[model samples]
Target: MSKISDVILRGVTGAFITNSGVGKIGMPAEHSAGLQQAAASGIPLMAKLPSDKFGTFIGYSEVGIGAALLAPFVPNKIAGAALTAFTGGLLSMYFRNPENTQADGIRPTQEGMPLAKDFFMLAIGLALMTQNEK
Candidate 1:
């Protein structure tokens, strides 16, 4: 990747992850909807854990991913791989909940749109991670 592309990827993804991580860590109350959704989705551990703790764990993970992507010393591929995996998990959760979308299933309802948008991040991370491999 070109220097500009590298910077753009790192900067955009870093900013987004940092913002989300900070919110998740700092504001548990605001994420109640997500907790409820998680429970409804029937994910094993997510439904069992206390919402605050679960949010905190997710926050920490996002923070770690953001830090890795933002750090100059970290390899782009490594950061990209982590981001890809993380967003994939988010996508999985979205898909697991049919109610998140409308009749078509492709179009997202208000509840599911956020997770649906993660595809961009996944794609960007995959591109950056694989770009240098030839």
Candidate 2:
């Protein structure tokens, strides 16, 4: 594994841990409140946030820590090159064709996406997450 792969993996890990962790934490309360508020306001309450609040912690932490461990191994020459390339390709595909998510609507303050490795991989990982939902 080379230093570059470590860098990419760490970048990805850091991002996933932070944002996903926040959503995992804050979303449930907000979701409940939103649903209640929407019901009060006679609006359609789209409960995107489910009652099981802690489950996201497991997935986010697992992936973040997993990525951190994998980062160092990404430089391992045995399979580092191939893994990094695959991650890069997945990232590239997401960057090229980003699916504007409803989550983006929740917080409109975020800037446009960049060519950063983590976001690229996030697009890939997030896609995988969605796929796995089936």
Candidate 3:
């Protein structure tokens, strides 16, 4: 049996990520193109994919990860691993893009605030992975 707090955490985070993925599934070409470009900054291989394909791929990936987290049968460690990997990629992208950070290099500029906030999600993922099963 899962702890109430853990269940709540998974439910909230999973729903948010799933919703985000759903929104990106049919994103416009221009939007996807821009997102692809940004992603490429961290993972150069992303540049090889077409914007539309990349967008669809990302959307599906998010949905799968979110679903894993939401599914009670899925182990917390497994779901946490997925979330960690996803957030790690986002954090890499945030650090790779110069425009996202300020002169200090760690701090976020106005445009980077959204990505900066992903650190919290990263922390949540880590927490889920480390929590002892009751």
TM-score to native of every candidate shown: 0.81, 0.30, 0.94
Cα lDDT tens digits, model 2, 62-104, are 4554454355443233223333444554344334333422344
Check candidate 1 and list the clashing pairs. none
Where does model 2 exceed 4 Å of error?
26-28, 32-119, 122-134
Could you say which candidate leads in TM-score?
3
Q: How many angstroms is residue 3 displaced in model 3 relative to the true structure, after the best TM-score fit?
A: 0.5
Q: CA RMSD for every model?
A: 2.8, 11.0, 1.2
Local accuracy of candidate 1 as per-residue lDDT tens digits, 1-134: 33778879987898899888877775565485476467447455566656656777777888899888888778789989999988877887778788777888767899999888998999988987887742
Q: What lDDT would each prediction earn against the true structure?
A: 0.78, 0.40, 0.89
- In model 3, pairs of residues that clash are none
RMSD of candidate 3 to true structure, Å: 1.2
In model 2, pairs of residues that clash are: 1-75, 1-76, 1-77, 2-75
- Sequence-dependent TM-score of model 2: 0.30
Question: Global CA lDDT of candidate 3, please?
Answer: 0.89
